[model samples]
Target: LENTEFNLLSMMYDVANILAFKAEEKGLELSCFIDPYIDPFVIGDPLRIRQVLINLTNNSLKFTEKGEVSIRGTLKEDLGNRFSLWFSVRDTGIGIPEEKLDKIFESFSQADTSTTRRFGGTGLRLSISRTLVEMMGGSLSVSSVEGKWSEFKFFIYLEKQASDSVSRKDIDIDLSTKNILIVDDNKTNRDILRQQLLKWKCKVVEAESGKAALAKMREAVDSMSPFNLAIVDLQMPAMDGLDFGRLVKSDDDLKSTILVLLSSVTNKGEIDTSKNIGSSRYLSKPLKQSDLYNCLMAMFYRESKSEKILETVSEPTGIIDGVKILLTEDNLINQKVAVKILEKSHHKVACANNGEEAVKMLEADHYDLVLMDCQMPVMDGYEATKLIRSKPEISAIPIIALTASALKGDREKCIEAGMDDYLTKPLKREELNMMLSKWANKKHKQ
Candidate 1:
């Protein structure tokens, strides 16, 4: 058993982000809620826990056609160093019939024969999930309403590392009097944000659209009780986040309020535009409470310290031009496409057909970063990264994995192999540039 100390919230966030694309593709909202009472740090097999979570969540997404899927963790019992945590994966999906529920966890078995034919799964996910949960000292159970919804719940015990627990009162920033505004087109999204903000003791106002948000901001300012911050959604109907932020920042009255723009995609252009228009921060959607808290803390605590807040809360502004990049790929077409994109950004680009060639090139020359492809002939990116990391002369140069695989755990696999970052294939220019810019300032070995 790999019992190690890790942050439960961070692990859940990783699972949520890894599956975010699949959730988006299905047009289903994927959200996670971790009860604040749950100990943040616990001793257990994080990998195993993460595996069970991914499997269960994947199963829920597979069966769900519309609506939402939510993963939640709540504290069942807390005894200082030992705690019982309850985890549930709930979905508004096709539910298991009461009669067939018993067979759902069987090996190679689904709810029914028609499910097997239509879903095209080996039906092993639940079997594995249940086994994993039981192995971790938990009994997995399910509840369903046949045609309505399904929830899989389990309770597991974990040993919390003996440390001083930090509560909201212990935090450095006091949010008790802060008035925040949340703008999102979806009620569920708004509710999620509202709950989190309320938990932090901040007063919150919700707006269903950018226009409504603008009205609220103006009204509050005129009433002499302006919102301290406005969390705006990027993709809204009439007036999106950028337009709303432009109006807010342009006005002398509302300019002092912090603006945070949330987007589902990592579009570099949008990030740059948000920053240029005086937005204080940009965060990803299906927002994590921890991230939002950190952003707010940075914004409020270092209100006058623009440089410090930027380093803490903001994305790298724009493309870092003129850095030399090593592109490693066995596919000729991918190499050509990447080189063209890099050259367009005014970056010096070099190509390697495979990992071995890439290593040889790196040894012979200096590059700011290595864009390593995960799979190739002779050697793969993982082995190449290991080899590069072993050599002190080249170890400090950043290695970013470029792969077409969006499979579960692919990102963790890349990081475990010593890659600094990951980028899925069919690359977007904006995302590529943003990733490069993020690592461009890394202290490279001379």
Candidate 2:
């Protein structure tokens, strides 16, 4: 879960651009364009906003075949203090019938049987998008021509920034002045890094392959504008990122350049393998802002940023075992109640409002165990746990899920997501204590 405030256009466009590679696989062109006049800075739940954009763009990609799928943003109203932002995803694939436009937005509905058979979706995207938009005080709308094209749009508002107050990452240095080169064969991964770095005002250049990246490096040296940093994906063809990193480090001409490795953790054990490569730092894939931010800080200065658990053993009984644990849940009432209960038992406890916060806390501090909520926003417990499992360093720390219900198959899903156990809601004091006792004493393996 990431909490950094970002420019509105950059945030939305990042989500839109990440799917470009997926569209490319289907032989379609995908792009995102933002209006220049928009204030661009806004503070909101970026993850939720991204979810809405990705869903819309993905839907457009599914039906698009011959032409392009594009995301466009423009200013709708200049309110002085704030502005209304409008975004649309237009596709030149199979268009929806005029009469069926409204029908498709209905719950569990698609355009028609033929549409479902060909495109393959539950038709729940618009329905879900409408709900999410309304929650953010926005409205979702659509327009299309039968068998020609489709355009889905939405409007949201953001307060204008009087000045630059987004984030400085607590460093006085201006990262905006730095030049960076991004290397990754996967278009989506490269775009993700570009969006993040560019938002910080850094100059960015892209290299689709490792060899191209090396060429760009040598060219920059010749031009007397060598990159300050190069973030390369750990997995690439013709030259693996490890070998590429070695080559860059060995080159006397590129002596001062910083190299950070990006790993996908496709092979769980490779997380350790990545560390063996010489570089400033290495991070797991689907790159995280906090991790990337700290990695940059380390290159300038080092420090920071976790996952699942195994079945833990119970400790000897006492008046209070004095076990320390981190509890991540979004419900304030539950937070208070859980803290009250744990404190009385002489257990040290801390809380995170959401999964994203939970991950950040785990990275910066130590906790004997984690009580994770399954459905919280930013990053769900399921995803958080999977990420933890990918990191060999923290994967063995036990995690128990806090789920609202124990519906059929819910346990399996939690376990698959890497949780060692789960606690049902309306949680009983006895159940909470028992689960903690099972996991609380065994510490994280160093």
Task: Look at candidate 2 and tell me the lDDT of residue 272.
Answer: 57
lDDT of 1: 0.78
Worst 10 residues of 2 by lDDT: 305-314
Candidate 1 accuracy as TM-score: 0.66
Residue-by-residue lDDT tens digits, candidate 2, 379-421: 8898887666544344445678999987766765675455667
After superposition, candidate 1 runs with Cα above 4 Å error = 164-172, 250-255, 266-268, 303-446
Q: Ten residues in a row with the worst lDDT in model 1?
A: 165-174
Candidate models: Cα lDDT each: 0.78, 0.69
- Writing each residue's lDDT as its tens digit, candidate 1 over 177-261 gives 8999999887777877887787778989999998888889899999999999999888788998899889988989888888999
Off by over 4 Å in 2: 1-78, 86-102, 112-125, 131-137, 142-152, 160-173, 186-192, 195-201, 265-268, 288-290, 302-446
**Which candidate should be chosen as best, given lDDT against the real structure?**
1
RMSD (Å) per prediction = 10.2, 13.2
Q: How far is candidate 1 from the true structure (C-alpha RMSD, Å)?
A: 10.2
